[model samples]
Target: MSLSLFDEPKLDSHCHVLDPARFPYAPDVAYRPAGQEQGTLAQYLQVMDAYGIRQSLLVGPNSGYGLDNRCLLDALQQHPDRFRGIAVVRNDTPREELQRLREAGVVGVAFNATLLGTEFYANTDPLLRHLADLDMFVQVQVEHDQLVALRPLLERNGARILIDHCGRPAPGGGLDQPGFQALLALARTGRTAVKLSGYQKFSTQPPPHADAQVFVRALLDAFTLDACFWASDWPFLKAPHRLDMGPLIRQVEQLLPDPADRARLWWETPRRWLGF
Candidate 1:
């Protein structure tokens, strides 16, 4: 049987598109690419079409692009029908600039603390309040341990949170660890969601790491399908080893085997959360 592109409605809840030629990595950054490279919207669209994805949430890449969301914003404009974006901005980014981004279809502001450090947004209530006023969700990429430190502030502001990569908890730490526990507690409030992606980054084992599965299953059980999202975490940033996106998708398929559950993770949930 031929595989049809529209086998299901798919919304890739996370990924990045960068144009290296236009925006090269800063030399001062801790990690630099081994080689000059570029990945574009056209390249990602082909992957999406092949994988039956109708839409995607394009996040700004941290390693190379820093706070410049131009490449990501440009992609969203080019394929407004198929892409929505989340951007990374400094805490002091102007309100008018943010409004312009909102007009360009950015639904959330990403705090890539995992790569840039949690202190980047520390004590920046003015910025947080601005985002809240704009009604934009805050997508955080902090390590699981960092969640505990952030909980009170997040709760106080009633910020809608999207925790990236299953909170990036230590694989050996287990669910009882403060970070995972904090995440579970946050989920209960109905104000937070977690992305079941980038498990490989936290595990030493191979793809579909059993250690990672423990966390993935726990998140699936904690968050309603509406509060959960999944992604390939394509190009698998800073992995100790390489990973193929195909197997990653299959792993998500395995985790969500029921058709309705699959539909929620693959489509509905992301549409509701990301507003794409």
Candidate 2:
């Protein structure tokens, strides 16, 4: 396999893996992945090896498993050096359980406000504080508009915040949009890190995602390189078109051609944030 040419160790900061045959979807699964081929841990490792990715953050497929983290925990246990996890957990989940997840190599907990609503946070404030106390990252997946309102609340309760999918910015909003601007401001605080990921999820244009570059540049200018991270959002779940990991990796290189910038985006930032 041809390894990455970049100087620093690479990490895909966001990806999900699941095998429905072994770990079936929750009864109330919000949505099922459209693809016939679900991502498996073994499959992800094959790609990681080919691309020279030294580590990865395996985010729980929340829609598939609900609050159950067995799939993600298993991956971490089997390959502790190569993987860390972000699990989906409920408000009432006990402290002992959270500690168990931490021992199992889960470094963060994810909440999908787009599906769960803001009240989810209201109910989970205690859990959020517990996560913060444990020094674990709090991952929030919400649309651009939610940032303005959510930022203050998160600042007060969350230890560190990871905004998923580039804040799910609206097309053509660019830097002027209040929500996007708020997201950039949050990044300026250094406590909030934005995943330079899920381009296909937010872009109006197709892959290689040229349209999203303008906003990304603005984020780099505002957030600084250390607060930004790059990820594959692999298996391309729910994306409009199929995307291969090779092109996605190349896209970051094209976006940040300077070796130093590429190293930060692909390695340093994620390594620090995810504790890899």
Q: lDDT: which candidate is best? A: 2
**Model 1 RMSD vs true structure:** 2.2
> Compared to the true structure, candidate 1 yields what TM-score?
0.92
Candidate 1 global lDDT: 0.78
Cα TM-score per model: 0.92, 0.93
lDDT of 2 at 106: 91
| Model 1, residue 53: C-alpha shift (Å) | 1.3
Model 1, range 1-276, lDDT digits (tens) per residue?
A: 633324667888888886677666665556544432346677778888778888988888776777777788889888898888889887787778778898899977888767667676677676667777887778888785888877776777765788888999986888899978988898877878889888876775886687898888888889978799888776556676667767776776677666678889888988887776
After aligning candidate 1 to the native by TM-score, how far in Å is the CA of 11 from where it should be? 1.0
The digit string of per-residue lDDT tens for model 2 on 1-276 reads: 533464346888889987777777788887777564378888899988877688998999776788878888889999999999999987787878888899899988897877776766776767878888888888888776777777777777866888888888887776788778778778656678888888887788888888988878887887788888888888777888778888887787788878778888888888988887
**Stretch of 10 with least lDDT, candidate 1:** 29-38
